[model samples]
Target: MVSKLKSANASAAGQITSRSPRQIAWRRFRRNKVGMVSAGISIVVLMLSLFAPVVCKILGINPDELNLDLIDSSGIPTLPNGGISWEHPLGLTPGIGRDLLANLLYGSRISFLVAFLTTGLAIFIGLIVGIVGGYFRGRIDDYLGRFTDFLLAFPAFFMIVALSEPMVARIQETGIAQGNGARVIFLIFFLSFFGWPGFSRLVRSQVLSLRERDFVTAAQAMGASRKRIIFKELMPNLWAPVIVVVSLSLPGYLAAEAVFSFLGIGIQPPATTWGILLDNARRFVTVYPNFFLITAGSLVLVVLAFNLVGDALRDALDPRSER
Candidate 1:
């Protein structure tokens, strides 16, 4: 009986020890009901956006193709006169007569793409700068710190606004950044350019505190290469904070893209982003409020879902939290 008990205890202990940190973290995240729900909604939104082309094909609707026959003499969709049909369930735009549902799905793809790419680029730059600067801790640190301070003081929004027209003109002349694709690339560049400073500073501060820890010191004393020590030892410990920062910042990036588009400097017309849709619908607010409401509602839903998920992630990843 004693031998059997020992064998069972060892098996359980082995299983417990084999579980990875990510598995444990996932378990903790799943226990948070709000977080799980938000994550599910976010995933659904992303999947819909990604598969929008397939959805549009199945629905037999073209987002960019205009149906002038559906418009009245005043160039507005006849949706207000009970013209909504199964073919265009979301009705049609007043001036363009483009399918609202198709536009929404495709627009969501652009929004998600811009947000994800900008966030990824910003994180990459910030991680490199922060890790290198914090690890070196000398003149290199001083230079990077000063650069970061300068970026923090810079007025990114106004700069983008002032330069957008001229930059677009230049890009057009280059024959490289054409049409909506150019605009999308430009917005991604502008947003990511301004997005990294806060993350870099946060990472630098964390690295400063962590570099002096016993494990890092032991790694150094044991003659580990700088690259190995930084990546293998320090990087693993940084994941918790990095993950929190990424979750929190993704919503901000998405909102920034919308704001830029609203101001007319983002993805231009014929490319229907949520911001563009909102701007186009604003003029017909009283005439057809559904257009404005639908776009705005989607924007709010995505942002709210991201914020909720971020909050839940922060709480779950916090070591001090008892959950």
Candidate 2:
């Protein structure tokens, strides 16, 4: 009876183990109502943005064109509720006179693009710095830790804002990128510069824990090169945290872009973003509150959706939680 019980337990364990982490995470994520809803919202927003050009075509509106006629002499939309009408469902942007719906769709694409690029670059730098510092202890690690501390301690946000124009100008002078592209390039660089340290520290801690495992010791014993051991034996284990952080931090990066744009330092003129819209609508809040509400509400909705998705991911990937 005891032997039979042991065999059954082992079989059960094997069956449970056979399900991959990804499968388990996905199952858990699917069961979360808030997560599922958030994911749906995120997908819809992304899809809308991805097909923005087509949507604009169907709407018979061009986001880039300025409709001066729609704006009255006072820089407010001619129609009531900030120009909300059948032709312009979300309304015309007050003063600017662009299709609000079209700008929103196009803006999401730009915001997401900047977030992704910044996240990718930051994570790449963090991974390399983390792996080196964690794998090789002592002086190298100490120096890196100090530098990371220094970066974290600095007033990097203001620095980024101050640096924006100069960097954009420098980039333009190089003739590498012009107009919105130059500002975008500079924004990505500065954002990544500020974003990497926290992630690197997280990775370093995880690496420290992992390097002490039996596999790493065995690899060291087998005359494995440092590069091979780090790459082969360690990197595979870092994906869970990476994914979690990326999901969580992406929203922050997106919000950062908006902040800079609101301050008139991000993406520059001729580029309509959530931030730009918010900035434009701010002055008209007393008379035309609807414009501000719509602009701000859209940003809040997307940010909130992304945040919930991130939460769901973190919960699903938590090792201590069987669910």
Candidate 3:
């Protein structure tokens, strides 16, 4: 009993202190070994991607520059084993003598940038439609709900594929954007245009319940402006889920970019993307299996890392979950 009392006293005096939610979340996240490892990998990849240009400058390599010497008469890379030489770190791309490491790094940067932009646009549209619909909960909600449902049921992927060529042409005709630039604008539009319904539904469901909370009710009783109550009272509480949703949504958009690029509909030529690499990989898969492996492996690694981090965030932010 005396020992127990002393231990409790020690904890109360030194070991125990009130932690903010952010601190508690970080503590819980650190306890998650898999999450920590994945986060480190993600941070490393993002950093490398962000500084790809500087790194390439230091290495004196242009990712898009074609080195005809590296290509043999047979159109296969001259290097015997995946191009790992003093000049080329990861290797020379099979038919194209562009540096593999350089392309990979640049690909990472562009792919993530597109994913981030698409996710942001989707989240913004979702937030607006969701909060308004949930708070009003009447004819207004019904109209908004139906619109989102229509988007959910629509064949967005097929539409994108079917319209890709003409869409790019149309955008180019309008002089808004051209070449792959136009394609990029079209791709971002198609993605975010159709991608928002799911998140909107998630937010609406959350807002529906959160609106009746004690704090919200107190705000209402205190004659807070509708706009203020919605933005201040409810929106602040929505951040946790919004963050988790955003984290989870990125990989999907990343894959989407890769898929469209592979199919010749995504960001156009001269762009170094994993999808473009994979699309090219099919031609040499039988002879140069390593080529396929590196591209596919990189994609798998980044996606898995993102998914694990998203799961960790979901767990860490759940108020009911045990530490």
lDDT of 2 by residue, 1-323 (tens): 99999999999988875678889889899988999999999899889989999989998877887889989888888877777787888988878798899999998888889999999999999998998899898999999999999999978889997788889989999999998999889889989998899999999999999999999999999999998988899999999889888888888999999999999999766777888888888999998888899989999998899999999999998878765
Model 1 segments beyond 4 Å from truth? 1-19, 80-84
Instruction: Please tell me which predicted candidate would have the highest lDDT against the true structure.
Output: 2
Report the CA-based lDDT of candidate 2 relative to the real structure: 0.89
lDDT of each: 0.86, 0.89, 0.88
- Answer with 1 or 2, whichever has the higher lDDT: 2
- Which of the predicted structures, 2 or 3, would earn the higher TM-score when compared with the native? 3
TM-score of 1: 0.91
C-alpha lDDT of residue 272 in model 3: 79
* Per-residue lDDT of model 1, residues 180-219, tens digit only: 7777778788788888988999889989999999999999
Per-candidate TM-scores read: 0.91, 0.91, 0.94
Report the C-alpha lDDT of model 3 over 144-243, residue by residue, as the tens digit.
9999989999899999999889989999999998887888888888899999999999899999999989999999999999999988999998998899
